[model samples]
Structures are given as C-alpha cells and as structure tokens.
Target: MQINGSVALVSGANRGIGRSFVEALLARGAAKVYAGARQPERLADLVDAGKGRLVPLKLDITQPADIAAAAGRCRDVTLLVNNAGINLQAGLIAAHDLAAARAEMETNYFGPLAMCRAFAPILQGNGGGAVINMLSILARVNLPMYGSLSASKAAALSLTQGVRAELATHGTLVVAVMPGAVDTEMERNFPPPKLAPAEAARAALDAVEQGAEEVYPGDMASGMSQGLAADAKAVEKDLAKYLPA
Candidate 1:
C-alpha cells in the first residue's frame, strides 16, 4: 500500500481533494498517476508537470461506460482513489424533490462501488494494491442539513467494509477516509475550522501506508468519531441543529 513506485488512478482529479491526492501522489514519487476527470483538458497542467508520468483520462464515475473505459486504460493501476463525489446539499425531509438525493447516492455511493467492482480484478492482477474511498465524518453521524449526502456516505462506508472483506483474499487494502469539513468550494460557506484538502489527502495516504482500515483525517473528524463511539445519540442530536447554507 506504499505510495512510492505505485501506479495509481484517482477519480475526480480536476479539483478539490482529488487534485490534492494527485499532487501528493506525484510528490511521493509514484511511478504513474492516471488523473481521472470529467474533462481531461482540465488536467493539462498536471500532465505537463508530470512529464509523461501523469496520464489524464476522461472519467465520470456515475457513468458505467466511463468506469469501464478507465479500468481498461489504467489496467496497471496498483492504487485506486475513489475521490469523485457530489453533494447535493439536500435534506431527507426538507428537500423539494428526491432527484438531488438520488444524484448524491449515484455519485457518492454507487460511484465508488462501481469503481471497486471494475478495478478489483485489475488490482488483483497487479498484486492486490489498495483502494481509498473519500468519506466524511457526516457518514458516521447524520447531519440534518445534508442528510442525503450523509446517508450516501454512510452507505459508501458500508460498501467499503464489504469490499475490504471480499478483497482480502487478493490482498487489496481498502481504506475509508472520513475527514470533517474539508476547505473546498463545496464547503466554502460551511463553518470554520475546516481541514485543507492537501492536509486531508496527505493524512489519508499516510493511513494507507500504515495499513489502517479506517482513517479520520483531521482533528474534527477524529474528535467526532470519538464522540460517536462514546454517545451516538448525543452526536446525532448535536448535528441535527445545523441547517444547510
């Protein structure tokens, strides 16, 4: 699960934590990084800087065709970072329609699940590498404001565990990274004390190298997880008050 000399593929590499993952992988001396994004041109700078080590691939995790294509193209991948996700900011009860909630599940939950399904064999063939799923602290405790997103992440967390068990025979390491309130455009209007994407990305990679099954990347995430472990109801009640911005 080491980063150095690994052939990695990171979905949603255009920006946010995904972009940070790509940068960190390069800095760690990865042999090659296939940056997956909806628009490949957005990764031109990274490709140039990679000097042939970074391969940009068009990928939309919600689309089966895109996942199939990426799996075919990045067959040598030893590490898969499922960083592609969407937050509709929809509430289970307050939202006008179910469309946004459905979209959230498609991207945040089903997307990573599909990637794992497609890449498991590739990783098995390449020596059972690793899969890192970018989750959230909200996954452990449902925040009423973004209930749909939280629920999707929660489902993803469950999927991560199942995948880990199934991939154990192949030696693929599955790491669920739950970071609280990352300082990204998606959380621009969110409360302060957010962890920077780069910091979160680094923490996640470190956990992978250390062979941790689950990682709470920042102080907030770690603290919140601890709280949930102690009193799940208290944490749920506390998060129930915050409304979407």
Candidate 2:
C-alpha cells in the first residue's frame, strides 16, 4: 500500500529504525503517524516536530493490553509497522540462562505476531492497507553469536509469510522487510557497511508502495539472500565464522 495520505502506526518509534520510519512516513505525506513506544515520553521531540501530525501512543508490543489499547486508539490506521524488537545478545546454547533468549522471542517474535493479529481487522475495515514486519537477513540464516535472536527472527519471518497468506483475502498487503546490520544502537558494535536507519526505512516503505511481498533493503541482505538461494550450507558456514561470544 502507498504511504501517501495513509494513517500509519509505527511501534518502537522512540529511536532507531522505528524513529526513522516515523519521520519518513510524515515526509511522505501521511495524514497521521502514531509514534508508539513503551515510554511515550521518549517521543516528545518527534511529536513536537510532527506539527500535530504525529501522535505519541504508549505501546509495549509484548503486552496484550497495550496491543488492544493501541488498536482501539489508532482505529483509523491503514499502515501498521511492527518494528518493535530487542536483541539481548543471547545465544541458543552458550547463554547462561534461557531468560534472555525467551525475552528476545517475546519481543521479537510474539510481539509482532500480536500486533498483526490486533491490526488485521483494523486494516480490513480501512480498505485493507498494509502491514510491514521489520525482519532481518539473519531470519533466513543463523548468526551463531546471536543465535537466539536469529531464531526468534526466523519465527517472525515464518509468521510474516503465514500472515501474508491469511490477510490476502482481505486485500491487506503484508510485507517482510529483511535488512542486514543497520547503523542503529542495536548493532552499534557490528562492523562497517551498515545501512543507515533512514535508508533502510525508506527502502522498506518503497517496497510496500511497489507491492513487494519481501524486500532485502541493503546490499548485505540482498547478497546473502541470493547466496542462500544458491548454496544455503555455504552461507551458513560463512556465518559460522562469527562464533558466539
């Protein structure tokens, strides 16, 4: 679905790629943009700068109450961006506890799943707009250092596909955005060649407008996707070099 003239809600909009999405949506002429965050106060500057176009909403995607409340409050929303996520640096086997891994799954996998479940009907009522899930290239291939996070993202990726098929009857466009390391606090320690948050956000929106089911927003993601298609084992072995910490 096109972003222009759309009413959009973006989760995790206080900072990182989520914040960038809020900005890009407004710049693209969206009628309204709901900047959702666990702490709505963190979006003060963005709300102010939105000049009445941006609405700050309290949203902790992991909470059922928050998801329901957000759906009730932002009923006019046509575009839902499920961008809220966490990377706890958890490894599947090497981590001291499963707590961190479970936390990652809650925020990264189930959170978005809940958001989509809550928003699907809203989108259908509003002419079946779109839902964008901010996934990662790692969803297709595990990174041993962040194995748990990768596994959670893979679950999200699978969820994205299933939701796409289910939502098609309603004409809702569900797009999966898979990008490599982005230059956000989430990947601050990662090596160079990271995509800027703004660039990644813009590309994802572009994909939505273009009716793309899946988007690889960066060179790294695009290359990796191609490599995985050609030789999955080779790509997995290459990624294995970055062992768990």
Q: Which TM-score value belongs to model 1?
A: 0.98
lDDT of 1 at 23: 95
Per-residue alpha-carbon lDDT of model 1 for 1-245, expressed as tens digits? 78999999999999999999999999999999999999999998999888889999999999999999988888899999999988888889889989989999999999999999999999999999999999998889899889899999999999999999999999999999999999998889888998999998999899889999999988899999999999999999899898765
TM-score of each: 0.98, 0.99
The candidate maximizing lDDT is 2
Candidate 2: tens digits of C-alpha lDDT, residues 38-57: 99999989988899999999
- How much is the lDDT of residue 30 in candidate 2? 96
Q: Which residue ranges in model 2 land beyond 4 Å of their true spot?
A: none
Candidate 2 steric clashes: 0
Q: Model 1: C-alpha RMSD to truth?
A: 0.9
lDDT minimum window of 10 residues, candidate 1: 236-245
How many clashing pairs per prediction, in order? 0, 0
Cα lDDT computed for each candidate against the true fold: 0.93, 0.94
